[model samples]
Target: MTTYPPNIAKLFEPRPRLKYLEHIDIAPKERSTPAVSGLSGYLAQLKSYDSEIQYTPTEGPIQKQQRERRERQRVQQAKVASDLARWNPSEDPQIQGDPFKTLFVGRLDYEVTELELQKKFAGFGPIERVRIVRDQRGKSRGYAFLIFNSEYDCRNAYKESNGMKINERELVTDIERGRTIKHWQPRRLGGGLGGRHYTKTRVWGGRTNTFGGPSGPRSVHQTRTAPRFGTRPAYSLRLGPTERRPYERQASNERPERDPRYGGKYGVYEKYKDVKTEAPYKYESRDSRDFRDRDARVPERREREPARDKKEDRTTRFDRSMY
Candidate 1:
């Protein structure tokens, strides 16, 4: 190791070129050795293990006992009443302030302190209190709560401070919804508004993305920089019933638009539906005078024949049998 200069300024000074240092012999470069594999490498590894694993053999029995003890402790801890009820939103007594006026600040840095949180958010409103949740061992759980004096202050803080960086971590802030929202469950129990909000679980196969993919096109609202894109109406999430909309009921009282491919008509040559004309289709007409295909394939209508008396028909059938 080279010795450092006693003075800080001497460190920045350029090094002097000595004759002996310049004449020092340097080794020629050589290619790095290729890695070995297959049976030969396996044998080499086996040879090394005999000496390397000597320390582990003596510790095995001790380690086994420790593992069993740890497992038993974990099972015992899980049975404890406090441990079982640890994450219950309603039952936690340490939670302070009104749910409406308190902000549940999550995604916090583990090192951030309560005093720092209080001071950081002090500009929003008068902070009633600040609490950074900790585990049984007093390690920060990367979440905290800030209690504001009023709901307005809480709302302001929630709006402005969410996604704000503190201690190199983006904070996720929201109003305490445990009491306000029904059937509330924390993230640990598979429910959380913040973490899930950032998730890419949004269904992509909407009108804009009929056949979605990994690099699908974004919706009009997302891509547009301005509030309104040209003269087009603002994009809406609600199932559309607006004018000139497709695949849904129209909001207007105008005439129902037909298929544009068939010239806004249901029939190819004649009118299928006419509320004003009351014209019926050719096949639907019962008028025999009407010109229509009556081929075998088209099922031609037959003339009705006179009905014979049952007695006469029976007599004819008996005569034929006698013959």
Candidate 2:
């Protein structure tokens, strides 16, 4: 049996008085106690009141754990988003090639076949594959995608064949980055007004205006004509020759043989003959002849009475013997 100190026994007391033992352990004259004893006593007390002592984890430690979990989840979500953004069939394990080496195109001619396009573009570089999208009805959708073996080859093909002509049509090409390449075919020649190419118009002679002259429907008819000649007759009237009386001739001969006034070589009648002949007096004759004929018919008369008696007699007799 081990013997214990009297103070140790007091420690087990139900109610011990320790007011007089103040600083007893540290006093110079006090006996030093083994540290093991104090340790054993403390262990006993802990066991006796173990249920009464409660422990809780610190807020800082719990918060640190939750932050670490959140960081891990965030990193995983970012990875999933990045993978979705750059998803591509060429990047799949089954497909073997540089995924970045490809191009998409639109605005393609419907009449152009995929083989024809591939053949045309194969001259530029090595083409892995050419795909022309088609609808459910097996008709082309007018678009395509082109895959090249090398990035440099794809770039060269893009540069050389971007605006390359195919059947009088130009094509457009766009490089596909991380996303799936969309097939784009060139639009038809008559797709829209802006994409159409204009052709030069032609004019024919006689069909169009010739040298700025009139040109249209014309009629066939005569524009000119010609000219026509002949013979006809004339008209006249006549007065025939007639006999003269002796008395009229004698009366013409005796009419003023001479004038006593100066030598009557020519009478006033002779003087005015030219004027009177030009303007002869008109008269009606019994035989419908001129006045000359009627005057010639009259007989010449010589008066037998005295000059005074002739003068007194208003009427005078004519002797035909005077002719």
Candidate 3:
């Protein structure tokens, strides 16, 4: 009899017995039994185990990590390529003419330099030129124009830039098609001074001259001389107080009085007054005393009176034959 260790014997502890009668005298297969198979299989497996299966080297771990990273990058690149293929430049037609020459409005970053702007927009397409309208001091006015080689590029730029907020302000991109051209015209300075009334001049350094200097000639020292008109004698027309002009005063006085004949103080009264006073007008009331008295004085036609029978007597009869 082969004696087994207690740990191995626990695998084959008998509980219920089988009563099959194929071969009563034959012993059970030793290799097929749990006690014999369990320990023998473990021993064979341990003898065949390699040390590489137990631990991986540092380089192997690094290579596995790098493989995972490369896979992620490839996936990202594939997605970007897919997006680029779907982008349509010609579906929305570009604005006609040179895009770089076109003006734009509503930029956000005033401090953003031209190079920075170009670089930012270059992601959309090739930028030809960028101009920021500035003050005399060359400070940005929060608006700028970007030009591109193609209209498609401009359209893309407009799509990307419009309503783009920078420095807390939203950009408003537009095409400046109808901007008015401004010309620098020299202003006439002395034109205001020559009028009959001494017109007020924009005083420059205490001078009454409209241009504030000599009218035409330039001094040898290049300094502007005082205007000659200031020294010229001005004629005065003096009038005594209460010197009432017969026609002027009457005309002025009669003009206001004539307004009352039409109606009241305001011009509105004339319409109401005409409707009340005018005869043969539809608005004149039939119930008025003037209408009643006029109707009473005019005799009624005898033919219009109620007819009486021949046998009936007519009282207070007047002669109809009198013309």
Candidate 4:
């Protein structure tokens, strides 16, 4: 241990001092009522008053929580019921509203550029950006998106540019609500020759497509019953190989058979094959005859000789004697 001066040792030594000020109480004080009317109390009360108006609900906290939960559940249930009631399975999903400040510019010509779109939309308001949606092949999808600095400008552009013709193409402008819906589409089963409007089954190329319900694209192997023809009673036997059932078969026994003698079905042409028809006038011959000859000159006839050159001498003697 090293020795030091008494005053120096005092500087190194731990000193004892009074823990309280003169005549001041240091022990735990007696309990006293809170000053509710004090200025600080008033300030705290004001803070609480703001909180009460904002969030300190009048009802019990548990009951308020339960009521809010019940309200949320009821709203959800109602939304689900409404969605169920309005649901159409056949319709494609559609986007309803616009959330972003983007406008959809449709019916754009393939030659139209982003600069042209920006220039056209800039007339309404300042455009933030212009994007013509393209595919992997880098060709425009016939639509473009235009983001504006404000929603007002977007709305203005959508309203003003709608149906406006550019480069001989009319524009279809609206807010970009994402996906579009086709309003008119063919029914699932019947598309063209055999559509759903047909009340019966229609078969083509050994495949059957039913028109009444949503059973679409059924093959011949999947069918349970025979398909019926359009509106006719079912026949016992099909008339032709291509024909299906349910058609009125024509009278097979009543029709006459083709004649086998005249080379079967072509018998009517047999008479006209080699037969030569005569003209209206009869053919004239080379020999001269009255009505048969076609020559213009008339034929001369021989004159009859006076009767009786042979018996002339005897007749003359008898006449002379009688005189």
Best by lDDT: 1
Order of quality (lDDT): 1, 4, 2, 3
lDDT of 4 by residue, 9-36 (tens): 7778867895985645544575466666
Tens-digit lDDT track of model 3 for 196-296: 23333543333334443435554232332224333222221221122222332335446654455665665657757745534433323333212222333
Stretches of model 4 off by over 4 angstroms after superposition:
1-98, 179-323
Taking all chains together, each candidate's TM-score versus the true structure is 0.38, 0.27, 0.24, 0.27
lDDT of candidate 1 over 206-285, digit per residue (tens): 54323323455665654444233344444433333223334343466765765555564334333444323343233443
* lDDT score of residue 271 within candidate 1: 40
lDDT of 1: 0.67
Q: Write the per-residue lDDT of candidate 2 for residues 144-206, one digit (tens) a residue.
A: 778887788888877777787788878877675334435322223211222322232223322
Candidate 2 regions off by >4 Å? 1-98, 178-323
| Model 3 regions more than 4 Å off | 1-103, 179-323
Worst ten in a row by lDDT for model 4 = 185-194
User: Of the candidates numbered 1 and 2, which has the greater lDDT value?
Assistant: 1
Candidate with best TM-score: 1
Top-down TM-score ranking: 1, 2, 4, 3
Q: Could you tell me the lDDT of residue 78 within candidate 3?
A: 85
RMSD of each candidate? Answer: 32.4, 56.6, 34.4, 45.0
Give candidate 4's error at residue 82 in angstroms.
Answer: 27
Query: Which sections of candidate 1 miss by over 4 Å?
Result: 1-87, 196-202, 205-323
- Model 1: how far residue 73 lies from native, Å: 21
